[model samples]
Target: MAHDAAYHWPPELMALLTDTIPLLCRSKDDVVDFLRGAGTSEALLGQFRQQLAVDRGAVSKYRIAREVLRQLNEQGDQGLGVRRALLRRVTEFEDFSTCWPDDQLKARGLVGQIRQVVGVKDSFTRMQQERDREHEARLADRRAAEEERRRRSALYSDLRAQLTALFPMEDPHKRGLELESLLNRFFALDGIGVRESFTLRLEDGEAAEQIDGVVELDGQTYLVEVKWWAKPLDINPVSRHMTRLMTRADVSGLMISASGYSAPAVAECERFLALKVMVLGELRELVLLLEREESLADWLRQKTRNAKLDRRPHTLLGVDF
Candidate 1:
């Protein structure tokens, strides 16, 4: 018969009889006896004894009750009945020297170790997520830099094309002169506020000749000569030209060449403290300055076209030839 109510026992008093039971008996009579020993009321004990006698002849009923007690203990119930049953089992096993074998104990330990390794794998997954974020950030930075460089390169190429179209020249020297003039004009239009050129009469007076270009800044005049020599430029001619311009005593001179300069020419140019010399590579930077002044670019295009028409032989004839 199943007990109709629950019960409790103090652990200190219960420990004395813990090893006395064998195989943890769960008979109703055992329950009644435990309650009576704990000083339960006679009325409650009488009711329990009546229930116990109803199944006294049925062994199967007793077995079922024992199995229920075992399940409750394995599931870790805190009820007094389950606790008493668990303590009885512990005592019975201790008295009989019953213990799990080495192999079974080892298998349990390995299962616990596997659980620890799985926890470490979870931490690795988190670290890999952090690394993926960092890698994506670096890739984003590189793409931004590459995009900026591509934009600058395109602007430079466009400006170069425009300059070539505006100042097409069969002679490389004339091309150099045209390039210098356009660059100076662009500089002035961009608010540099400098005089850009001057004409000089030769001593023999065969024809009037113009110096390449000039710029005035802060009360100083800078005479300039431009060269587009595909080969190296000797500085002697440039030095001589600058000397002539400097005869006025008020002018400082500069020389800009598309091709590189000879070493001696560079040294000669350096001799004059007020003179500056720049080569093709340096001149390429002017395109960047022009990009910031779009109006100057437009004016240069117009001036170049007008100059072309004026120099045409048909225009000189006064009729459409």
Candidate 2:
């Protein structure tokens, strides 16, 4: 009995025929022989017979050929030859020139392209995560370093304040000499020293001139004059003082004032001693040195205790609270 025309094969089975016609059948005669002997269902056979009767241009052939090659590349040639030969028989009259429409082909190609884009996006996301972690680590390191520097600066400032309070100066000469001594102690220099009330007498029947203090630093002797005046002093006297000190070979001179020096005095001192004369701010920087000594904290505590005792009033003997 002939197969009924109303019965059709499943769409998925029909799609299989469309994908396998290309690489197997070489000629129309080969396709006819393949269909007659294949174990296809009666309904599919009838559809194949009818499709073979139509003009080949009305069916898609090149799409079937390309689809077959793509499947072979993807799935390997595992017993696919028989299916290829059956599809060729159903579309024996179809030419490669009359294939599916361009839109249908483009739609099929989009799936693979979308998968490639998703892979690229995933790689970019992973790289960004790594960079973010590295940036955070660097920020953490910078914060730690800044905190350490602040700690060091605070420690230095505290030491300077303590030294400034220790040496209170009433006279300019006494103040400058004491300041020079403090500087020497802070630096811990051996031969480089500071002495107050240094008396000098010239061999040419000269009257004795007492220098406030003499500092020997770096193999050079410096005669320093100190003043604690409320107002600035004239530079001419300092210049003259420096001149006398300079005449004593290998001697330099500096003048320090708590109220600061007059502009003319500063300029004149600079002219005589050049770079040897330096104006140091009274802001003591002794903390840097104190921090290095292990016994400084104990020493400061003792001094504070002594100061407190001295400030207290003497009690009557054997008096009870």
Candidate 3:
């Protein structure tokens, strides 16, 4: 479409292209064969390709003719012409049969009324490339998410094994202290920070109670009690935990017993219902959750919510899903 370069084309070459517009429908191979048969050499071929871009000197005379020949062989048809001293332009359907019969060019219009193929091939190629890239990006994101989940699961499982190995201690008081240490280490590994046993004051000079453990995890304060007694804990101990929790309306309580509770105590806890006050947990559930590499903080929060909403806790037992 560079009319100025066309202007540089020699008048003889311009006349030749205008006269032989129908001859442009041939394939590149057919055109080459014709040129070779006519004794046109490879040097002439390169020289002809050069003239289409610009007219530097004597070689530029055939530029417009060669440009039309190139486009015809590639696809469809294009013609060179003069209008107001500029080249007239249009790309039209090329008739391949014209090359074989050598007579179809005269039968068809010189720059005929064949409809333009609306560039479907180019658009399809571009859209497919975009879809491939999007698919690859989504696959990469899923792989990264899976790798992070596996890392968290492996770390939690290792810490769980350590905690499980310490369960055989016979002395209740020493076992309770070791259990508390293990709980702290487990909580830290699971990304929750905890505080040691603290003395709770009743807004007076006297200390009201000694908390077994205190932890602010998942936006709630937990007042924890750990018991590893050989005997099943009766209602008295469970009732004591409920009383301490009731003292502070905002605090949630965790009562983890290795030996578990008596039938009457379990019955009392099942009937116990309050708002974010108590969460009944077992040493077994902690072991399972850690062995499965699950989040203890998340389990505690669910239990705490269940106490308020469902009026029941200790639902984490034997859960595999």
Candidate 4:
């Protein structure tokens, strides 16, 4: 699954690259600029420049280019990207007319050689990508299933710990916050979109409404209100949620109660079902579903279905709808 970390250029390819560099540029200054632009170290270029000044005719520009390329090749993969860029740039030059007329054909030939090398590399890269795509396609479904199992298992473990911790939390406010966080994580685990508790402000910056969480399921938005009261949630809080739902057009309501719902509260939600879909949930049922490793998204879909079809605001997980 791993590729080689180093790229070793062949002796022939090195010679081709070195020979092509001088041809790609018209003068020694052009040669200096070309190497400098290709990311050659200033120290190396300085050494080349000093040598050129000392013995202008003794060391040829092609020889200096070869030395620079050789040192880069010794750097292995570290220099591979720069070398490839140089090769690509060499091949991109359209005019050899600036080259000496006698050496023009030779320059064209050297550029052609570099192009062939670059072309082979590109073809190999494309082939590798295509093969990787095909390989991934073969394992996509199984890998996705395994990844989902792992993800849900992790989420379940986290939620179970959070649930256990909630029992010992003495502060009702902190416990309510923890429960809202737990519910958000549970919904998000199965890929349901969730927005944590947020307060909507009025025009004067006063708090207009406090939403425990927001969740989107089956293309419908639901304003979520989570209550962890000791007694069964009565009609007052439920009615407040109903009033909030009334202000928003085409939005539904999801109310989760830790202490369960009183008959009147359930009846209140049922009344609101005529205007908007309202799905009520008990914390115990959610705990049970998590214990059984049930899908929260699927369960919500079923709850929404039952709410729409049977006009029932609440349904137990194990009970037949």
lDDT of 3 by residue, 248-321 (tens): 86787788987777878877777666344666778888888877677787888788777777777656555534
Q: Which candidate is the best by TM-score?
A: 4
Q: For model 1, how does the per-residue alpha-carbon lDDT over 245-265 read when each residue is reduced to its tens digit?
A: 656666555455555567676
Clashing pairs in 2: 56-93, 56-94, 172-226, 172-227, 172-228, 173-226, 235-265
Choose the strongest candidate by lDDT.
Answer: 4
Hey, what RMSD does candidate 3 come out at?
12.3
Q: Model 4: how large is the Cα RMSD against the reference? A: 9.6
lDDT of each: 0.48, 0.47, 0.63, 0.84
**TM-score attained by model 1:** 0.36
- Candidate 2 per-residue lDDT, tens place, 1-321, comes to 132332222233444443434223443333433454553334334443455578554444444333333333233344255444543444343333332454334423432333344456459768998898999999999999998667655644654665566456456665555565565453333234566556778898575776766665555565656555667767666666766665676665545454555668655644543434432221211232345532322322332233234321111111222
Better of 1 and 4 by TM-score: 4
Instruction: Give the worst 10-residue stretch by lDDT in candidate 4.
Output: 1-10
What TM-score number comes out for model 4?
Answer: 0.56
Lowest summed-lDDT stretch of 10 residues in model 1? Answer: 312-321
Assess every candidate by TM-score: 0.36, 0.32, 0.53, 0.56
- Is candidate 1 or 3 superior in TM-score? 3
Colliding pairs, model 1: none
CA shift at 101, candidate 1, in angstroms?
A: 99
Candidate 2 deviant stretches above 4 angstroms: 1-162, 166-184, 187-191, 201-207, 273-321
Clashes of each: 0, 7, 1, 0
Model 3 pairs whose backbones collide = 51-63
Model 3 misplaced stretches (Cα beyond 4 Å): 1-129, 170-174, 184-209, 214-221, 267-276, 294-298, 301-306, 313-316, 319-321
